[model samples]
Target: MRFSVFTLFPELLRPFTQEALLGRAAARGLLAFDLIDLREYAGNRWRKVDDAPYGGGAGMVIRVDVAAAALESLEAVPDEVILLTPAGQRFDQKMAEELAQQNHLALLCGRYEGFDARVETLVTREVSLGDFVMMGGEAAAACLLEAVARLRPGVIGDEQSWRADSYSSGLLDYPEYTRPAEWRAQAVPEVLQGGNHAAIERWRRDRALERTLARRPDLLATAGLTPQDSAALLSAGLSAEQLAQVGAPPPPRKSRKKTPAPAVPES
Candidate 1:
């Protein structure tokens, strides 16, 4: 896959492109990336890419002219043109999987307060990391890139790796251990050391369900659990009662009682 990032701060994205998994993807030709400096598209003396909003807001908006020009320079139409902003669809693992299947991706990293509303008209889609805001969209873009990269054909060696990852099937992953069975007085699960593949698989599934139930019950709503899976979870010490709590809403807090007024001092 080919990813193109148009940003005012291209340097902010360099670190990710040069290290760890991303770096490996680049080296192995599993993925390709191009960082286009949005400032470069500004031909004026100061090379400005933002301007005060027409309605006069606290922060400057990305100028439509410069942003449009930057996008035009890409020549070919990307499979998806993603604009990073807080107002768009929430990005997630499913979206990452969809993006990895695309032939090309163009990411526009909004800066200042936000992108001009007109900029949205050109992009094919928009995505937001979550509810909170960030200093810039560069980090969001990097996140999107990493998620997509990991799903590429050769980027990850194990095909079954992602399938078992947290949220891959709406359930969190089970605990994992390696090296010497004993570490810091905590021993690895005995089932893991037993070399019984069937038991290990059953144990992992149950643990994954338990972990999800404990940490993120909201996930269980869409877990699509089967009767066999439920039995497995129960056998692993998690009862139907415990599984019931997975998606249960917390009870409302009790209101505090008001203090009584003191009797009048004057007679």
Candidate 2:
């Protein structure tokens, strides 16, 4: 896959494209990265890319013209043009996998107050990291790139490696341990130590469910819940009351104290 990034601060994003998993992908030509400087498309000697909002705003917005010029210069049409903005859909693993299927991508990184409103019209889609705000979209784009890169064939050594990743199966990944079988008085789970693959797998799934139930019950809303999964949960000590949580229930009401009112001021 190829990614074309349009930003004013290309230097900040350079190291990420050349390090760790990303670096390996780039070296193998499994992934290709292109950095485009919006300033290069600027019309003036100073090459300004941002300006005060037309009506009024606290911070400057990227000028639509500058961004358009950079986008227009691309020799090949991008499979998808993504404008990174907080108003867009929250990005996740599923989205990353979807993006990896695209042959090419153009990422428009916004800064200051954000891109000019017109810039949205130029892109095919928009994505946000989360509900919270960030200083710029470059870091978010880098994160997204890494997430997508790891899913690409030949990028990661083991194809099955991602199966156990948190969010891959809509459950938080089980805890992992390595090296010292006995460390600091804490021993590794016996299931993992024993050479029984099936038992170890069951242990992992059970622990993953337990962790997810404890931390992110919200994810269970749409996650896979098979007969075996239900049985596993039951075996893991979760009662029918917990499985019922997957279905509807009324909002919990506050329990009031039963203290009686005193006939105090009997004036």
Candidate 3:
């Protein structure tokens, strides 16, 4: 996949794409990055891309015309253009998966107060990392890039690794243990060390369920639980009533209404 990042601070974004898994992915030809400096597209001699808000706002707003020019200057338009801002729709694992399938992605990073309102019209989607605000969109763009990039084929060495990631299965990840099974008086779980694949898999699933139910029960509402999963939760001490509260359908109950007693005899 190819990603084009339009940012006033290309230096801030360059190092990240050149390091870690992203760098390896680029080197292997699994992913590509193009950093388009927004400042270079500024019309003024001073290379000014932002100015005081039209109605006298506190901080400068990125000019709509300059941003538009930058978008137009791209040799080949991207499949999707994303604007990073606080007001955008919340970016999530689902969106990352969706974006990973795209042939090309363009991320537009805003600085100062934000992009001009008109600039939003040109983008396909607007995404925000979360509820919090940041100094600039560069960080958010990097985050989105990493999230989407890792999902690309061959980008991550092991495909199964990402499948087990938290939120990927709509459940928190199962706890993992390393060497030194006995450390600081803490021993690894017997199930993990037992070498029984079936038992180990069951243990991991139950722990994932337990952790998600305890920490982020909201995820269970749409986690696509199976009969076996329900059984696992029940075996882990979750009552049917409690499971129902998390959107698990309760088992059917048989009615026991008594038959009318001998009314014909009294008549």
Candidate 4:
């Protein structure tokens, strides 16, 4: 996938893409980046991209003209031009999967108080990391980039890892242990050491259910559960109301293992 991240501080996002999994993906051509500096489109000697709001706001607002110009500079039309803002849709694993399907993407980083409201006209979508605000969209852009890039083929180096990831299956991830069997008086579960695949799968699913129940019970409303899984959870103390909310597992989406990346569309 190709990502054009438009930011005033391109250098800040460079090292993030250059190191870790993103770096490796770029090396193999599974991912691409065009960290275009937004300041270049400022159209001024000082390259000013932001100005005080017309209504006299406390902080400056990114100019719509500059942002639109920066987006127009892309060589290829992106499937979507994502504008990062606190008000956009709350991003999730599902959205990440959807984005992975698109071959090209442009991320518009907001600075100061954020973009002029009219800038929305030029963007295909708006995304938010969460409820809180940030100094700029560079950090949010980096986060969204990494999550989507890893879903592409060969990025994580393991297809199964995607399937078992938290929220990929509509449940929290099971516990994991490593190294010495016994550490600090804590011993690895015997089910793991016995090499029983079926038993291990059951153990994992059960643990995942337990964790999700104790934490985000809300996820169970849409999470697909097998008869056996429902039975196990029912036995494990899922109440009647939650059980009513449970649904049969939806058909699994097609896997994106071929080509350079898969969406895991973080679905």
Model number with the top lDDT: 3
Worst 10 residues of 2 by lDDT: 246-255
Q: Per-residue CA lDDT of candidate 3, range 128-188, in tens? A: 9999999999999999999999998888889999989999988999999989999999999
Clashing residue pairs, backbone N/CA/C < 3 A, model 2 = none
Query: Where does the lowest 10-residue lDDT sum fall in candidate 3?
Result: 246-255
| Cα deviation of 43, candidate 3, in Å | 0.8
Deviation from native of the Cα of residue 250 in model 4, angstroms:
16
Give per-residue CA lDDT, model 1, range 159-234, as digits (tens).
6898789887778989999989898999999999998999999788888877876788678777877665666556
What TM-score goes with each of the models?
A: 0.86, 0.89, 0.91, 0.90
> What are the per-model numbers of colliding residue pairs?
0, 0, 0, 7
Residue 262 Cα positional deviation in candidate 1, in Å, after optimal superposition: 82
lDDT of 2 by residue, 137-200 (tens): 8998898888988899999999788966999888899899998999889999888989999998
Candidate 4: residue 146 lDDT (0-100): 87
Give the runs in model 4 whose Cα sits over 4 Å from its true position: 247-267
Score each candidate by Cα lDDT: 0.85, 0.86, 0.90, 0.88
If both were scored by TM-score, which would come out higher, candidate 1 or candidate 4? 4
Can you rank all candidates by TM-score, best first? 3, 4, 2, 1
